[model samples]
Target: MVQLSNNSALIFDGLALESYVSGKRSFMRTPSVSLLLPSPEGTRRAFLIMRNVTAINPLCLPAKAWQQNVAAAVRPAQLPGVQSHSGCHNQTGTCVDDSNAPVWQRCWKQVCQNIDVACSGARLNSAGNPAPTYYDINLLDVALFCPVVLDQACLDSLGPLGCTLLYESGAGPGMLPAAPLAVALGDATGSQGGGHGSATPLVVGVIVGGVVLLVVAVGVVVLLVRRRRPQAQTAKTGGAPFHEGLDSLGTRSTTSAAGTVGLSMLPTESTARAFPTMGSAGSGATGSGHAAPSTWPLPDANKRAHSQGSDTTVITNQTPIGDCEFDVKIEMPPQDGVAGACVGGSAQPDVQLTGIVLGRGAFGRVYQGIYNGQAVAVKLLTELTVDSADQACEAMMQELEVLGRCNHPNVVKVLAASSLDAARPALVLELMETSLDKVLYAKPGHLLSLQLVLHIALETAKGLAYLHPTVLHRDLKPANVLLRDPGSDKPVVKLSDFGLSRIRHSVLKTMHPEAGTPAYMAPECFDLTAGGLTHRTDCYSFGVLLWEMLAGAQPWYGMTAVQIAYEVTLLSRRLPLRPKNTPGGQVLERWPHRLSALLSGCFERDPQRRPAAADIVKALALAQQDLDNLSRRATPTRTAVE
Candidate 1:
């Protein structure tokens, strides 16, 4: 992982070996990621690479080769002003003939085209200077035969490379060193020079070549010394000598070329055929290691031995709804003269909150209160709710059904809900200081305290685990999670908001309606028949929220909610937010990607492929635990503190 600046970061996971040396096809098309810029500077541009391998999945060979193709395609353009010649015409009046040109030429054409599009009607800041635009060029480990240049042609056009912009050489053949220099284009607007005659262009080329040579020289020396080191022995044995990050070398083995692998060796059936059934199948596989199909309600009580084995690795066997039965009823409460207004005595003043307004919504306002002398949050449904009584009642019912039986420390407890009155069906909830969105984005710093973020993720997962049985908190964005304090060393996150939540019983499981905040909705939600929405939907939302929390803002950018949703579903639109000056960006530049991959398992268009909420909890818990261990090891022990 690598941190570019205070605002951006990056994480890289392993790509197949062929992406570096072979011309293979890539598996990930339009790889979307969330990115952040420290200051809205002029066009932030970056290059990302993924490399490293511990084991070889022969089936993934094609994907590896494709990754290399993408990397190779993007590298040559790094030469700054060394534009690739192609039949490309941009607003700059530059023409590129990409048909007969090399990959670099094509890359250059694309970059130029992007610049033209980005700068269109771009506004200037108060200082009358164009705000910095941002661009991220992804080169997924295509092996480079020569060093690439970063010069004025590229830098001046794009401004500072925001967040993490790296050149990685791993897998395939190792990357050759490149001289990173700045090219001085004297008055770039000047008239074109004579064909191959201008001294200015020639001098710039000479400078670039000189820098390349220097880098190569140093690289050669480094390689030679590395070859002689004891670590070389391990490297030759297909073992990595360095850790994976922007600076580390990631390598995988592949003796057979990509195409040589027989298709027969791969599964001939469609991915759908290989998929397991939804809820029932999930419970069967999880409750017992034997892997059978489960019935409705997840019958694990009689299968002790199997449950124990599966419980260690699989989570479907554990259902939060096991012992409790939900009491369902339909009754309309009375409403005062005010539309949706419901009044009640202040009997719980001891536990009612005072003057502070904890939250607000389109319907009404929520205030802090005290209940039993403890802090509480009271939400007063407004007259508007009474006006739309039917829809409001249904929404409230859904919330109660889902949240009433939920049990998790991270989830806000619904002490009580009064739907007796259409005008005042107020809800009582445990009080917390603020929402995750407020802590991470509303305030000035805009950065989540690292430890606090980790804790929040953990606690939220715990709550999710409990919701997996009969309900799934479909809306799991930062705004739905409450924070305990502004100054607490460790922030406590409590999951809230169950209006869009759903309850999925084994016997009553059905698809969920497409509804949620655009930025947080999972791809699977688009399909109304997606029965797996029970737990997997939450996972997808979690991924988006995680990215936003790390980036300190919204996960996707668009002018409106509709645009954001469309981009997310079709294009997987994402911005790169890693910082350019920090190692965090280098090491974790692709962390968001890993999260996306996991979310895919949960957010599968098909529910069967989606892992249960319990699985999600386990995976996230493990990740958090790993981080904790790493932190403990990194921190020096102080006698007084200890």
Candidate 2:
């Protein structure tokens, strides 16, 4: 216990502050404590303790249990063994301890404000359940240790507190002590999501900080670092906290708290949500065209992902892509060999194969692998789809030629290609987490909002526009559109699987009549006799995708592929638009008339009359603008909080 004078303070044995002093900023893994402001009864407070405190996996917690735990975490309680702060002047009413130090009080107030917003958002789901969430601890860490670790500017960001904590008292830069820091740099030791094998999985829990900070110590910026005896860890299940920084301070450690921290939390595969994580934000997609992923301030899913409020029907798969309402997609046959060089001059050797197959197809398989230090998708050709080795080699060459030329952020990229004579002919490609179809059908609470729909549409259209006038993605259905959320709730869409695409083709009768998915194909696809295939063929498919997204269901929920071809091509029928929402998951009140009109243009009977991909991109951009205006009008401007 410390003094309760004009600047009353609580003290810990001094935890992780030592590591920051030792220059292990990147490895500061510690349990984070965030105070939730209680109802304004003169500085009452409660805090949520994170970093593997609960025994059961938070993902598996029942709705009731989850709520109880959260209630417990946020319940107001006095600091243990400490009385009211007579010196505490909490005019703002966010402080918990009595500290006259401006920096100390100011830091807690700012933290309380942010926690106020996040706790409200993360506390409940649409069904009013307590959804598990990972609140960022970095924000708090920066405030408390700014002077001790961060530069002058970093310390300055916290306003007057900066000078008061660092220079004003001449106590010098200081902070509370923490657990020993530790670091283990290596690849994730292969634990696929949702695996329930008997083998004990050494799951690396997200290490916000592998520490328990208890006190709001006051004095000099830092009390001289006291080496507290190692605290025993509470029981944990399935996974253990990953320790960050080097374990230079202690010999006592948990079985698994021996590795990295300061990383993003891994989602349990049981939830079926594979959004982009700061760590391994999807294997491919790491080319120069894409920006490095960053950590985002994620709010509650219910705040952004609203219920679809669309048709809830069961769709049974007929063929690969169901159309008798068969909505399942079937793989298209590979084309004959291309004459150009598949490997050109920059041929890459076999990828560092993890042997983890991501997907399998008729001509080959996609593997989760690493290439030159980056996670990548390795698409390899095999003899299963072809009669001979030569045929397999030719198929790989053809697929590579089509994708190798594409270099755009919105298109799946080809990083490297193998030679036709290599031991394993493969294509090293950027990997995204899930297909657009998955995003559209994401759990009711994580479905698409209009802003996201338009975003996916604009990005997809841009990819198409880049390919047009030269290539035709004969199949442009939702299944071909890949998505990666990259920390932001909005998923980034990129076109993939150009297996059915044709490049630099002529009106000369094509070789494969059944080249595209029947549901997404243009009428001319049914009868090349009707008209020649062009980029317009892809527009029709894109329009169908837009309908699927709005409807939040398959385009032809109950129709067969043969029937779809007949109805769409001959009768000129289209599925109705599904309902859509805004960023906050509320019904987009501005409703997209422009989007309806664009769909009409795309579905024009005459290919010549259909809007081009570039035209579609422009129209989608307008819808985005409409969303911005609607948001501004709906939300009242307020002075900034804290």
Candidate 3:
């Protein structure tokens, strides 16, 4: 006989059971019966009545009979409590001497009861003291101890109710089940009535209702988890930022700094993320260690384009439009003495100035502005020095000329120009999030994967390729490479800042003073008399940029611009390659031999030996293919982090 609160008693007869309340008549006698009694804390406790007990003492009951009774009463499949072990509990009502049972089963009774009762005199310790027994067990411990029983298939088959109960009672592989179980437990404990005279049937009904509600809630959670599994797996395996709606073809829409809209189709985010890191950002070609890739923005549809020479190839699904009124204005004579000139209308007065400076350079200051309610970057020429007014004007016009003629996707565009007041000339250009130089320096530890580096190399080369035969970006460095933040898509890189750029034909005859960053200047650039500056000059700067991307350190550290110029011009010194065992070299070690050879070719001292921009694109494509193949052959690894 067991006594419950509210003066209730469960009496076991030899063949039947009776539930009686003090000061009230006996309710009923039945072969098998159960009662759900409400506690002061508003939690329900389940009590089972054992009928036809041959032995009055609970401990004297046969082990097999006890197991059968407990199993039938608890019904773990339906209630998610203990599976019933005769050895788990003895006559004293203490959970003890359950060494033969699995650890999970030994602790299941306490887990289901949500209690922390201590066992006394269960076993002896080496110190001759009573060894304490804890009924609490963690879910991770259960999964680790009994992986086969709690495998994915078994967990799924448990259904929401059983699974929630088991999970709440400490079962599963991760902490994911803890939250839902907590909610279920809290709700179950909060829904009970405090009245003492409530009917047994009403109390049971409430408990059942709470269980059903908890099951539904857990089922909903299970569905949501199943839905996010694919995305979570992709993020874990890919190791790159996830993007939504990215399709197999890797196509996306982008807008340029010039407001020119275009479409770009590149590799998917997973493919890009899997690319290995080649070097640290901003590290010079000779740096000893490599830095992880930072978040480099990929070009969007408006800023990316594919073209073969003069023919625009629409690889992505987009419509092409004719030239707009905002065409760039070229003051200089056309290349090869061509008669046609590209001109654009004056800037609209409606353009609003925000006065927020985005960046500053020797030539001018770039400010974040708004035009037609769209964000833009406005480059204003610096105030002329006492004797440099004419020179500054000429530089501004040269920039306008080069930018105006450029319609390629990778090149920055000029939206409009205002020279009506020559003293305050300004160029309204498309705004970019930041420059490659800033990206490298800002995120020193974020190593870029090889695939993304190759992509940048290819895009930069494409811009240069388009500029060749018509224009030359005399100053090509990481600083000039502008990036657009695509939010969810990969970042887009565009070549900007053409203050020193020159038309190809004019460069062949002109022997002007040095006009670009000395560190990026090719050997020929130091002595214009050796051979006129050509498109190849840009190649040399590109090679240096490549080295910077791989080395992730400053070029010629501890040397000034003058020293760098002298070293390349007089000493005939070039950027050094990484030795085999260095940290930076380790990054390069993963590269395919073809890629290494390509880098070597790009850095060749002989201008003629260096590959053209188009050739560089082809080489990068091949390297990217190698990376894709490697990713395909790789097996997925399980990660604990999201």
**Predicted structure with the largest TM-score when compared to the true one:** 3
What lDDT does model 3 reach? Answer: 0.44
Ranking by TM-score: 3, 2, 1
Candidate 3 residue runs with Cα over 4 Å from true position: 1-348, 486-489, 579-583, 636-642
- In model 1, the worst 10-residue window by lDDT is 195-204
The TM-scores, one per candidate, come to 0.43, 0.43, 0.45
Top candidate (lDDT): 3
RMSD of each: 26.1, 28.5, 33.7
In the range 1-642, model 1's lDDT, one tens digit per residue, is 011221121223332221111111111221211111222333222222322221111112122222232222222222132212221221244433221122233222112111110011112235422232232323222222111222222222222121002111111111111111111111122211110000011110101111223353344334433432332343332222322111222221111111010000111221110111111111221122221112112223223232111222212211222222111111222236332212443332223335467778866567776555577677655546436766665566556545544555666766655533434556667778778776665665356654555567767776676555445666788778887765676667778988766543221122234677767777656543222234556766776666565556566544576776566566755434453332223436235443445545654433445666567667666666666786798788898468
User: How would you encode candidate 2's per-residue C-alpha lDDT over 1-642 as one tens digit per residue?
Assistant: 111111111111112211111112221111122111111212111122222110101011122222222233321222222111112111365632211123234222111111111121122235522232232211211212121222333223332222222322222222111111111111122111111111111212212122222233212112211100011122322233333232344322222332212212222222121111111112121111222122212233223322211122111100011100101111212235432232223343235556577778766778776666788787766535335667566555545545654556777877665544554467777888878766666666455666677878888888887777446678788878988863365667788886555443122124354577787777767863321355677888888878666656566657888898888866877655434332221344424789878988888766667898878989998888988898997787785432
* Candidate 3 global TM-score: 0.45
Which wins on TM-score, candidate 1 or candidate 3? 3
- Tens digit of per-residue lDDT, candidate 3, span 90-154: 22344322222222332221121111111110112354222211111111101111111223332
